[model samples]
Target: MTLYQLHAKQRLPISKQEAWDFLSDPKNLKVITPDHMGFHILSGADRNMYQGQIIQYIVKPFPMVSTKWVTEITHVKDGGYFVDEQRFGPYALWHHKHFIKEIPGGVEMEDIVDYKLPMGFLGDLVHPFMVKKQLQKIFKYREAKLIELFGKMEKEENYLVLRKI
Candidate 1:
């Protein structure tokens, strides 16, 4: 199995609380996600993200085939940060951490996702390039939609953190 990481950071022209509130809401995901992927929240919105919570969704990876993903909220720290992990899905592993911090005039939002593709060695032969392309398209659309929806700041730029220890 091989792991690939993707990190995206954006500075919003709003308070930390505002940023936290938006990201914390599961329903807001559809608004920020790319339309092509067909992302939707299947459950876990009623209680509003407590530990032991599970969020389910059907992601259309291709035209006819759909992957059902069930993610468990492993960690939560009130309004500061949260982590979601894939319990049952196509990927071998998926850990996504969402962090928000209050900066001078706005909030700094960071998303760190470490995921592994399936099929041990054969996975690399077919899925790596396609998966990377799909993710890039999704995240790129998200960045543009965020700026349009949240009203951007000067620091609304994403970065790649090659190493995190």
Candidate 2:
């Protein structure tokens, strides 16, 4: 099977700790995702994101249909980075790493994910090219969603965790 990698980066004006705390909370995902995507936590916040924590989610890419995914946090660093691997989902394998660094200007957030879809050759034939556009759309929505939330909560020393897009 071929491995797929996705890289995304963002610069936020917020403090390191603030960004870390916000991103560290798994429940906070709904807050930063677009409403149209219909993102929701299938499992409660019992496992807020510790090593071996399995979190479940229900996401609707469009309007009616939805997909369920379960992921486990494999590793975590206090304020540096964390990794999540898909335990059960549509993909053959999914390993996602989120890295954060404190910069002079602000905090830099990076996302590095390695994933492989199901159906081996069939997945390659149909998805590799089409999936890129879909992912871009999702991330764009996330970027805008972050801008709105951070903008609303903007204040001194409270950097809102990202640049206003």
Candidate 3:
């Protein structure tokens, strides 16, 4: 299986603790995701994240097809980083890492995802046309949603500037 990696980063005008508090809670995912994706938490999302935490959700990744996804929070470092791996999902494999660091004016959050599709060559063939575009769209929606919620912190030349919303 060939693993595909996706990386996304954004700077927000918020504290590291605030970013951690929001991102570590699985319930907040639907808030940042696009509504058309039908992302909804089914269980284990009402509390704070912990190592070995399992979150279940129902998502309509394709039209008229509802899929059940289960992921486990395998590793977590308070206010720093966390790793989530798919236990049962559409993908053959999914390992995602979330990182947050306090930057000059706020916090910089980063996401790194490594995933592989189920049908091997067939999946690879469709990836560029389908999966890759879908993932990119998801992350783009997430970035805009985050900026809407916390405003944006941008580096202007030699300094970081916090844009007021």
Could you give the candidate ranking by TM-score, starting with the highest?
A: 3, 1, 2
lDDT-based ranking: 3, 1, 2
- The lDDT values for all models are 0.80, 0.73, 0.84
Best by TM-score: 3
lDDT per residue for candidate 2 within 1-165, as digits (tens), equals 677777777767778888888888998888877777688888845645688888889887546868898989999988889999988876788888988888775777788777776887887775645555566677666666765655422232321121111
* Candidate 3 lDDT over residue span 36-91, tens digit each: 88999999997999998999999988778889999999999999999999999899
Worst window of 10 by summed lDDT in candidate 2: 156-165
Q: lDDT by residue for model 1 over 104-140, one digit each (tens)?
A: 8788888899988798778666554677777777777
Instruction: Superpose all Cα atoms of candidate 3 onto the true structure and report the RMSD in Å to 1 decimal.
Output: 6.0
The window of 10 residues in a row where model 3 has the poorest summed lDDT is 156-165
TM-score computed on alpha carbons, candidate 3: 0.92
Collision count for each candidate, in order? 0, 2, 0
How displaced is residue 4 in candidate 3, in Å? 0.5
Candidate 1 CA-lDDT value: 0.80
Question: What clash count does candidate 3 reach?
Answer: 0
Candidate 2 RMSD computed on C-alpha atoms after optimal superposition onto the true structure: 5.9
